[model samples]
Target: MHRFTRILTRVVAPVGAVALAAAFTTASFSPAAADTAPAASGPAQNYLVLYKSGGSAAGASLAAIAQARGAVVQNYAQIGVAVVSSGASGFAARLQAADPSVDSAAATASFGVSLAGDAATDAADPVSPPTPAPGSDNLSGLQWDMNQIHAPEARSISGGSSSVVVGDIDTGLDFTHPDLAPNVDFSRSVSCLGGVPDQTPSAWMDDNGHGTHTAGTIAAAKNGIGIVGVAPNVKLAGIKAGDAAGFFFPEAVVCAFMWASTHGIQVTNNSYFADPWLFNCKNDPAQRAIWESERRAIRFAQQQGTTVVAALGNFADDLAHPTQDLQSPDNTTPVARDVTNACAVVPTEIPGVIGVTADGNKQFKSFYSNYGVGAANVMAPGGDSVLQRTAAAVNGRVLSTWPASRIGSCLRKVFDSGATYCYIQGTSMASPHVAGVAALVVSSGVTSPGAVAAQIMGTADPIACPDTAMYAFFPSVDNGAPQVCQGGTAYNSFSGNGQVNALRAIGG
Candidate 1:
């Protein structure tokens, strides 16, 4: 029913897109073993100095930083923040005191945490399902996630348009993987880690497997080999933002958005909760820079025609009505603090971004997924290992492409046709299902972020809250906190507008 037909496979030429990479080194730390340092006194530490809005660009703050014995590394002039490296112990306060144009300066690591430490790869998903149908990929039977969202049925009508490029802004991707090679947009792909763009494929290759898995779910080729993606014919650009260890610095995230917007990336699948504090509090002066800088970058990307789809989180808390934050300041000594609605998870909770929660094949919200009334905008099959297990979903996990070289610790891994694959779960896996749907929508000529979002929500299938008693079994998942559901059946927190329907997304 859409205008454009499916596109043929072609390699997008490499385009040149940094290590401002040495600034936030976990090895270069103060003896405290904490991510924060009182003085820039040890090895140089990286800090993001936020300039007041409508003021001078990051360059204007450079002089003040240098006067405080710090040197400006990368300047995100668009967002008015400067990445500064200094060996002086008290550089941030001194820089702010020396410059009236500066709002606040905070250590980059103080606000960036690795989501789910294993790069979104979780254990407890070891069981493998029986072989798929004879003609399909040998492992297709394990793809209950594709079947749940009706992606294959949708693909019969549309596999997305190649012109609409979707960027997976996570760990670097494995472009050599057969499933991803055909649709890989080599030209638009770049690594923004360390706060700069490096277009070299080796620079952005998948040192960590998270990016490859997400990329596979979004746009793996329908090449009759590995599993086919939700939007198999669309282009996939791997924009590496998270490091191999999985730390996502705020500056790196900002650089990624700037790159995506400037390069015309239509959709970016961000399965991360940027910043070290799980819940960044606005009133807190220490966190304002991290909160505002990242928010503005996302807003700018949206303004420039990039639709961002993010995972709600794995915290299992009600994001809409937040109370206490048990896990925060993740890189340093974690102090359990009382939180209110004033605090929120980065990127996902940020305005205008599409927030997705995860559910298994049984249609129950994953016990590890974060949810709240009106918090998430949509839901997808992220897989739940405990409650949703079935014959097909042996361990109730989503299966996708994995790197052949990396000897990852994923409980179960599949070697198919000489390539490696694995089973994993998280809102991380759930987000791409919707991102792929968003790509399908974008392929239909709904290019604007707002219109693309509207199309995705309009086509989703709504679901009501499940029995509250179900939460009892998974109480141990999130520190024994009680999971509650709010809103009507048509629009609840757990399932959001509803599970995404790929066929409906493309008007099949």
Candidate 2:
């Protein structure tokens, strides 16, 4: 049993505060680096240049320089540029001299930038890594328990029938992971980095572990060995929109949605959120344009019958403040104090997405989980009991998959070679459980993402308020005011539709 208490909702300090928006200018390419004469050439060269302006501009300059050098400028963007060069040696100096503003340049070969063409060929006809067979190290008995969930059983009855493809529009995925290899549709995977046009799957490999863990929850191989997934048989795809550092620029996210539309992917899971302050500045044209564009993309996905699942964010708030203060019981107004504001409740509030919140067996929303009436749609298990794996998980434990390399690094730094995995917790971990469940619903011959969402919402167990006790109390305007309880009937501004019951969800 989990304690749930209702507390007034108020705006508190921002979590993971975002810097104020900065004005940006387009990057100009240096004409000095451009080759005037046609190539009386030897071997064709490829170069990627980094500029001071931004990665997007650096890419543009590289394209212009490629044209001047008699080589073709394949693609250009703000951060970096890629070009096929006729001559190799003094290209860097020539480019620098061509434009004083140009910051620096490097050859793609020197940087070990693998082309999508090469990566695809390798993936298509490659040797498999020595991954331990699934279930080989079933060290945790959790897998066995998850198997009893209705989603997986429904998938089995359908003979693995779901053809719906869900796009993970976040960080790239580890395409080579043994648990995910069989189910991922590599053909649709794309990266928005340099405009290298081959749609081959190299971009799908997750350098950061966030996307991989999400992917695992959605469709980890059900080979009766590794961790079982909610929709183990559902088709999954990856969109490499996020960078290695886990930051996603608006351009990248927009491009990813356009790419998903073109690639025939039907469902997209966006387990990422932008800062709430962004909406506060709703008057900015650029920000408004970005938001509109996001809305358009989501609408486009819906037109194509794609379902979008988003995280409700992890910014928990108190419901009292000057900006959001409630009247005191004594009929006296007090000075406004900052209260916890539900900041993570943005885009989830956007029309099309099925926003998910994190819940544990205790049935209460995670302390970090944001709450608001139209913000979260459902809650799912995101691991509770702590297991030693990573620094973040040291306090709140959530069971899920992780990249072996990253886990090893953390283990080496902390406990030496003794640790292989860490129990972690976050709405990020919870989003996938819903995504997987959605996949299961889709696989049951449902074509509409909206329909799948409806089924999920309809099937969840309704929890009643005041059904549980308060775990703790924080000072608010009214001391005796009822705090939120874990389980409840009628939606409490916290856990929506109660915790997801896989059995009830699949209508089994």
Q: What is the C-alpha RMSD of each candidate to the true structure, in Å?
A: 11.3, 12.6
For model 1 the TM-score comes to 0.85
**Residue 56 shift from truth in candidate 1, angstroms:** 3.9
Q: Which candidate has the highest TM-score of all?
A: 1
Model 1, C-alpha of 400: deviation from truth (Å): 0.5
Residue ranges of candidate 1 with Cα displaced over 4 Å: 1-40, 57-60, 110-136, 476-479
Residue 360 of model 2: what lDDT? 51
Candidate No. with top lDDT: 1
**lDDT by residue for model 1 (361-476), tens:** 89878877888776789899988887889988998888888887674645578877777787888888999999999988877777789999988888889888999787764442
Taking the tens digit of each residue's C-alpha lDDT, what string does model 2 give over 1-508?
0001011011122322312223334344443433453334444544434344443334455454654462433323312333334464555556666655455443332112233331221111111111111232242344322442344444444323335567887678777666677787877777754324335576656666677777777777666445656666666788876656554444445456556665666667777653212231223332343354445556655765667787765444322211322211101222222223321223465676887776554555655555556666787655433222233333344444556666652321222123223345566767777777776666555557778888888887665543324423322221223335433475655667766656566566
Root mean square deviation (Cα) for candidate 1: 11.3
